[model samples]
Target: MMFNKLFSFFTVFLIGSSICFAQNANRLDSLVTVLENNKLPKNEKIQLLIKIAHNHTNTDEGMHYAKQSLQMAIEINDLVLQSQAWEEIGTIEQRLGNKNNALDAIFKALHIYDSLNLKDKQAASYMQIGGHHVGEKEYDPAIIYFQKAEKIYSEIEDDLYLAFVLTNLGEAYRFEGQLENATTSLTKALELNKSLKNDVVEGYALGNLGMVYAAESKFTKAKTFLTKAIAITNRLQGAYPTCVYIAALGSVYEKEGDFLLSESKYTEAFAMAKSAGLKEQIRDFSAVLTGFYEKHSDYKKALKFQKVYQQYQDSLVNRENIQKNEQLKADYEVSKRESEISILNITNANQKRWGIALISGFVILLFLAYLLYRGNREIKKSNQVLSDQKELISKREQEKALLLQELNHRVKNNLQMVSSLLNLQSRELTGHPAREAILSGKYRVEALSLVHRKLYQEGVDTKIPLKDYIQELVLGLFEGYNAEFEPNFSIADINIGIDVAIPLALIINEMVINSLKYAYDGIENPLLKIVIMQETKEDLHLQVIDNGIGFTKNDNEKNNSFGLKLITSLIEQLEGTMERINTKGTHWEMKIKLS
Candidate 1:
């Protein structure tokens, strides 16, 4: 199933490549014959050259004609024509597998189009650039460029080209595993092509939609769409894309558990691809068959197809290598010619400059010696000033650190005094409802006091190690409640600043108090677990679980409880969420966003 999905992705590029070079040979010949007329006007000749180049894509002849058209357009100062010529050159180079050169030429065309405000041509250039990105399997940039082209084509009401961009855009979405988006774009493309009566692009749109369905595992719909696509391509005699659709149908069959039918379809598609001389399709289908046979435990057939796949893979690599060698040779020739011209120019100029060169050299030496002496003197003065400034900055930083430490120590002492006063007040109101509230307030104050104490002792003013603080906080709660066992702790190593630490500490205090008071009633062995970890760079996950009597309906509905309200307020202040579960015990899960 995975192989089939990958096969669908690989064949989209093959389909695109085939469409590019599938022009009628007779039409190309007619264009060449017309080009033979020497009396043709320059502008008409330039247009003819571009047309011929488009028909000859993926061939050196196409590049030659494109360059010729570009030169003529430059001579006539026609920016639109020049841009069109560059677009053709880019498309041909891309089809010939020269990506960098392709992008360079396409951007050149885009620059010219932008300067001229040629919306239609600019959109076309964007589509070409998008197609290049798709060929490289870079779907993000491909989708971006395709959307740019889609917008312009829609604005211009160019339904034909709009369909083309939409089709490619849908294929890119499918490649990126965005099946719903792929369906949307392909369906729109299918409608546009139908309205425009463009059978070729219509077939492509249908084929891509089928692949999207196949990826989603909707085998019935997959077969339906792929069968329709096959019909269209078959009627149009599109052998390459037809074979691709057939292979996609085979994948659908494989996923549906129709092994015999799947094998037949795979073999049929392979035979058709081989007959059509589609090397990429042949290589891909060979691989698919290799996998299919291996799964069926047919080692003999698997080995045979594996060797065939390797052969075609090697052939494609060799073809790319040959193209690179030819490019290198052309570059070397150009460089050699440039070097010969530079040598000639240098030789002619050197014959008349010997006496002046000696005079300039002597003057330069004296100027260099004087500048070096001045540079040394300035360097010494700058170094002395830099040293003094550095020392002053260091002294100021130390003073600031000492001031922060003193402030934290004072704050901790003041918080401890407040807690002591709350404790005294709580003792005075014995058996009174207000005593509970005072004690809760005292605990909250202690939570904040711990944070400051940690800062003062650690001598770090800003952030505190939260795991150590949480351990101490939880241990203190257990001791305050006189619990029989310590709660399990699974805390990650995280440091947080005071802004987050204060509110987070208060939240934990409220939650632990509620669990100790309400949970663990009549339980033989109470269990408590506290988990704190960073779930992402900007989020922290905390879980406080206890195994005791679960919360009753009344407990769950206590929205007005002071402790519950306090917990909610602190969580809100921290920009966090809380979830409570009551099964065997109480479970408190919270995710806080870190600033």
Candidate 2:
């Protein structure tokens, strides 16, 4: 990674290269000479001093310059320069690991920027805050800050900074394991950087894109993207991020079953990380290369890297523990000094004074005993109340379960009666189409009745296990059709609310009936499949497919049948969408959102 890329991601909001550019002695001389020429405005001079302070943030001189700039800005009452000074101070604090203090300083800058309507500066401050949050690994808050910065950058038509913020936002999302969102944001950033001819931004974005694709196991695309990214970073001599890209490519090659290429890339990345003195990257490469060698049956190399990785990991842990121990020791000394001073405040006392103190202590002990006795009584009373409430809650739950069971039983009976009425009516019909319609209606009613039957079968769980319900429903449909081929079901054990279940069952009934009545006509070895699964926490997917004969768009337009319309209506009722795919036969997919 170039220093800019590291500043963008690893550091807490380093801003642009201009903010902390490598110190050029000639440029520093020119700025100092300009400052010495007393004709310039003080506010302008303060800005120059702030730039100097920003450049020196890694040293004590940085703090001195920032304080001097802040003092001058205050004397002139220049809010703009003051805000700039505070932000520089905040950057220094963040680098020193004083996160809370950094936040305070940055927010102060943000407030002034907001007051001055300095949209770009406000965006910069937001990005800084976001980077701080990312350093803390509070990704959600970091995303929110980045989003705020994004909005400002958008308003100002600052596409370059916007792209930078998006890249960071994508990294945050990637770390949070939101791969889809990360891909979207990073792809946008990549496009913008390319359009703007920003090679640095483009390189970083490509590296991130490669990592995202690799995580999704799109190895071909991952390899292509990472190869391009590595080429770019190599041309720019960005060894840090180049190591990252190489490591990512190594993992992709590993997964692609190219052990030789994987090892080569990993070895190269390790060498780069070692040269860069990036301890974390060194540890990571060692562990992954160890695994690669082991998988390749090279036990000696595996053991070597394994030992190297363990040594680095142990060193890191020891360093952290030592720092913690030092802090604890310092805290102990402070407390011990306070204790010694407290002891020295006491002096020798007479016997009469000691006796009075003992009497007072005895009286205080008696009072505490009375209070403890009362506290025990209160605890007993509270426990008694809790026990009674627990019994009441249990009783109420049982009663509710019984009531729901009874309701389901009644609804099932009512629906079954309706089904029987339709069956009787179908028997009296002479016309073939009329009789078929009646039977279809009867089956539709029976589908819903089956839900209630299963609802009350085992317990009063209102949410029904869809696997067993779908199995029973398909069997009932087979019996109704008197067909030899039984439909197959791949149903997950997902429980859906009754409101959604009723409409879903009706929708399935309509689609399956239409397939059996029309699609399978004159077709041998008819096949039917039903799959119900939860795609996500919010999405439930249902697919009913058949392999017999298919219908075209023109056929659907000509028919516009009641079954099709009913399916559409029921899907709408359940707040879902349906798509029909016809090839050898018809496939109906319904996507429903759960409440």
Clashes of each: 0, 2
- Per-residue accuracy of model 1 over 298-413 as CA lDDT, tens digit each: 76687678778766755554234434544644654565467579999998788547644665668787577568768987999999999999999987886677677767877886
The C-alpha stretches of model 1 lying farther than 4 A from their native spots are 4-26, 56-79, 92-101, 231-240, 257-283, 307-595
What are the C-alpha RMSDs, in order, of all predicted structures?
A: 20.3, 21.1
Task: Estimate every model's Cα lDDT from 0 to 1.
Answer: 0.78, 0.74
Can you write out model 2's per-residue Cα lDDT over 1-595, one digit (the tens) per residue? 2111222233333343353323455666677788788888888878877777665413356667777888999999989878888888887665544555566678778777866888889889988878777755678998998999889889989898888888878877876678899899888998887778776667767888888787787878888888998988776555656887887887787778888888889899999878755565677788787667755656667668876776665454422333443454365346546756766556334554675566675877867866886999899999999999999998788667777776787688678657755765675575777898788889988988988988877566878877877788878887877878888888888777778777888887877777777788888789999988898998898899998678866776855678777888888877889887756788888898777
53: Cα error in model 1, Å: 4.3
Model 2, runs deviating above 4 Å: 1-118, 132-137, 234-237, 293-595
Model 1: lDDT to the true structure: 0.78
Q: Candidate 1 at residue 284, lDDT?
A: 87
| Predicted structure with the largest TM-score when compared to the true one | 1
